[model samples]
Target: MNIVVCIKQVPDSTQVKVDPKTGTLIRAGVPSILNPYDHYALERALEIKAKTGAKITVLSMGPAQAIAVIRLALALGADRGILLSDRAFAGSDTWATSYALAQAIKKIGPADLIICGQMAIDGDTAQTGPGIAYHLDIPQITFCTEVDSDGTKVLVKKLIDGGHQMMEASLPALITTTMPHDYKAKYPSFLAAFHAQDKQTETWTAADVNADLAKLGLEGSPTRVGRIFPPPAREKGEIYSGSPAELATKIVEILKKENLIK
Candidate 1:
């Protein structure tokens, strides 16, 4: 079975700050790490590989620096890594990004399964996975916390409103995973990391993927970010101290004065 895991490198949110004047992220001096959700997804793929002996290929679309996360995936047991990097892919929104990745997957040959994180931390837009599924015209299961496969079909435990949903999808399908609350990510040993440097890793461009120029980058993006800013600080709650009856009256008066009640 050939399985492709999509991963990303993202800035450490805790160390990131917004440029108030520019309404953009201040990336200078900020450290980057593999997106935690994607890390979990890679781990899930590795587990499936252990069970089925599936060949795992990690894929990412970002700047050349993004190869760090792909190499990390290799160290954790992915067979190979593919990085889709190009100037044409710059300023791509979720839709365009999905288009580019879908094209790359085709170039990678037939894949039995594709795994992705529920969302990237920097964007928090859980749309790319579904978009890729759409572009590939394949079935998809999202928000899964666990995944297992037998080389023909995939069984997953999906998170829903208040509980989990067990689901199954045939081969050549896509899945986006969400890590469990208690989940702890894994790192490779020094030896493993050292050996990962010898693994096969390739850098592909838009031209290599045969992507339609009209369907990539900012030109293909339908959504535009107006601006980004931190939410206003929350106001302190008003304190009330009185007898039960007095408190009831006070609440009624306040609600009425605030036009919250008739």
Candidate 2:
């Protein structure tokens, strides 16, 4: 089986900052790490590979700096990695991003499965994975908590609001995983780290993927950020200090004055 895992490099939440003028993230100079949620998806992919001898390939689209996340995926047991980077791809929203990724997947030829995290921490939209599936016109299962393969078909346990539902899908499908999907990720071995460092990740651009020039970047994105601002600070609470009886009376009086209690 050939599996493709989509991963992204995100700014460490602790170090994230916004550009006041543009209302966009200040990516340059911010410390970046692999999106934590993607680790769950990667771990699931590795588990499947371990069980079925599947070949896992990690794919990412970002600036050249995204190579860091791809290398990290290799260290975690991916068979190979690919980086899709181009100046024109900057400022792409989820729609354009998925379109670009779908094209890249087509360039990779054929695959048995595509896996991704439920959502990116920075964007929190949870749309890219399904959006990719939409562009590719493939069946997609989202918020998958458990996955079992019988060689020809995949059995999945999907998380719902109150519980889970089991479903089966044919091979060559896409899945978006959430936290505690199956197991914790394993640490990278020294050998794997060394190999990852030396591995030459395949790099592709919009042209390499035969993407339409007009629909490959920010211009192709349908949504636009209108404004962004930090939430206002909360107001201070009123203090009620005294004996329990006195406090209760004060609270009742305050509530009555505020018309909260009849």
Candidate 3:
């Protein structure tokens, strides 16, 4: 079986800042980490590989710095890696980004399965994976928390708004994973990391992927960021501890005072 996992390098959100002038992230000097959800997705793929002897290929797109995440994936037992890096890919929105990745996947050859995180923390717009499915004309399942396969069909546990559902799909399908609430990402050991450095990794450009030049970057993006600003700071809240009746009365009075209720 051949499995491909799509991963991303993202700024540590807690330490990231937005540039007000450009409406862009201030990536300068911001430490990057593998997108946490992608970590879980990779772990799941590795587990499957162990059972089926599948070859796992880690695929990602970003600046050269993104190579770090690919190396991490290889160290953690991925068979190899592919990094899609090109100046033409900068500022690509979900649509263009997915198009580029779908093109690369075609070049890499057909995959029995393709996996991706439900969303990237940096963008939080869970559209890329589904967009890739659209571009490739493949069926996909999103928000999957678990997956199992028997080489021809895949079974998955998928999350929904109120609960989750079990689903099955045929081979050559795509799935997007959602990490468990308590999921803790794993790192590679020293020896494993050293060995991973010797593993194969290819860097591809838009032209190499045969991507249309007009749809490779910001110009191809339909969504434009007008501006980005932090939400207004919230004021402290007053806490009242009392019996239910007393609390209810106090809440009513406060709501009436604030004209929130009649």
lDDT per residue as tens, model 1, 120-146? 999999999999999999999999999
Per-residue lDDT tens digits for candidate 2, residues 7-59, read 99999987778888988888899999888778788988888898999888899
Better of 1 and 2 by lDDT: 1
Candidate 3 overall lDDT versus native: 0.93
Each model's lDDT: 0.94, 0.88, 0.93
10 residues in a row with least lDDT, candidate 1 = 20-29
TM-scores for candidates 1 onward, in order? 0.88, 0.88, 0.90
Worst 10 residues of 2 by lDDT: 178-187
- Any runs in candidate 2 off by more than 4 Å, and if so which? 181-185, 233-262
- Number of the top lDDT candidate: 1
Q: What tens digits encode model 3's per-residue C-alpha lDDT throughout 19-111?
A: 878878888899999999899999999989989999999999999989999999999999989999999999899999999999999988989
Which residues of candidate 3, in runs, are more than 4 Å off? 234-262
Strongest candidate by TM-score: 3
> What ranking of all candidate models by lDDT puts the best one first?
1, 3, 2
